[model samples]
Target chain A: MLIRELERLENLLQPWREFEYINREVFRTLSPVQVEFPLVNLWKNEDKVVVTTEMPGVESEGVEINVTGKTITLRFERKPEELKDGEAYTRRERRYGEFKRTIELPFNVQSDKVEAKFSKGILYIELPRAEAEKPRKITVKSE
Target chain B: MAETVKDKNRENRKIYAPAVDIIETTNNILLFADMPGVNEKTVDVTVEKNLLTIHGMIEPTIDDKLTLVFSEYGSGDYQRVFSLTDEIDKNNIKATVRNGVLKLVLPKTEKIKTRKIEVSGEA
Candidate 1:
């Protein structure tokens, strides 16, 4: 119970720390900066692992994927969308910036045979299971 | 696993509000919506009685065979509405959906007439 309370307090303190950091940076450079990361989903089975991420406004050329051992790293750079001169914006919710996401796999995967596909703003990656990670059945010797 | 069993009504899928950016220019307005799981065939944009609505359907996430390891974003249909004003030329508006992003270009005014001027002193 005490650990949970501490965690709650930490979560509440994070925003204030970020606010202070932003203010300090704003004083140094008369400009503001913001960043956002896309959401990710992972699904795994006996033979393969599938990873999906939502990355709207990211061009196909701006995505980079690297797999080393049981971890995968994704980097994205999306161009900031702009409006013409004299235009007014009514509502703005989507954000544009550069971000990176790295996640460890549940198990070791075959890095050489990994495949990635991008469609409709979603990035789908399929990683085959390593031979050692695949399930094996053992036979018993008869007495 | 618990999220699916709690709601058995398949037709009552949750409606999500898609992230969008609305920008205006002197001659037109541009709307960009993030709908990553939707394709052109699955998206519908309609304007009725000055009410503009955008709808996109995404595949359900509940699967019997595949086991979920980790998830961050919710999966469902996206629906959003905006009121149109007289400044917009609805007839010339065009929209395109690619890679789950929808871009709608709303022109500011109607077509302008071109007048041919001839000078008497011109050869």
Candidate 2:
């Protein structure tokens, strides 16, 4: 009974025995396999809300952008390569799949007048604010 | 048994080479793998006997009728093998995938030396 308890204790304590070296090895082996993708950023301006995302290596037509009222959605698909028979891959790390991301805006936006542009793997979305939503300046009179 | 282990290790090492980035901080080590389109269902990450392996399959999404205008990222299967030494708390390793980025947090082992002390004596 005591031996079994000791074994269980050892098992529980195993992960804490060697963390530094494992971390170093994990970092050392990561450089060649690292993949970087685009991140989406949304900000509001005086007249519009700008959405920018890094999407390097994707075609403009392959991406679909849609907006409904206060919500915006994006969807895209990527294809994999064709391999010949009897040919084995040495190193394969790129990803090819479909993805979708949707974000909600603080205020209602005009979907019909929205503008989108893709250049150098970056997608820029400009959403014009409704006439009522734009900030208005009012003069204050001293009483 | 040792020879077989070595042979298997060599075979695994030769099969797929994945580029990896290991970011180390005070609390843990973050492993970021550029596995572009690998879904969570198909991806596998395992650690055994100090050896960590990440393997997954990436399928193409294009059709025959479509023509590609530009492509900077290639799509294919993903595989990476790593041999770890001491310094990892294997049991506490955590992994999460978001937006095609595989993030792994490897915490430092409690038994490993983490600090040094300086002793002073009166002359």
- The number of the candidate with the highest lDDT is 1
What is the Cα root-mean-square deviation between model 1 and the actual structure? 10.6
Model 1 Cα lDDT, one tens digit per residue, B3-105? 6764555356656667788776656678888998888898999877666788898875335566889987767787776777776777887999977889998
Model 1: CA > 4 A from native: A1-36, B1-10, B60-64, B110-123
Q: Which lDDT tens digits does candidate 2 get at residues A1-143?
A: 00001222332444532353365358658868443334466667567777766553467899999999889898887554444443233334445678677877767899999999865345778888888888899999999
The runs of at least 3 residues in candidate 2 whose Cα sits more than 4 Å from the true structure, single-residue gaps closed, are: A1-143, B1-18, B69-71, B116-123
Best by DockQ: 1
Chain B TM-score of every predicted model: 0.76, 0.70
TM-score of chain A of each: 0.70, 0.65
- The residue-by-residue lDDT of candidate 1 on A10-66, one tens digit each, is 324556434644664576577454432678889998998888899987887889999
CA-lDDT, candidates in order? 0.76, 0.61
CA RMSD per model (angstroms): 10.6, 20.9
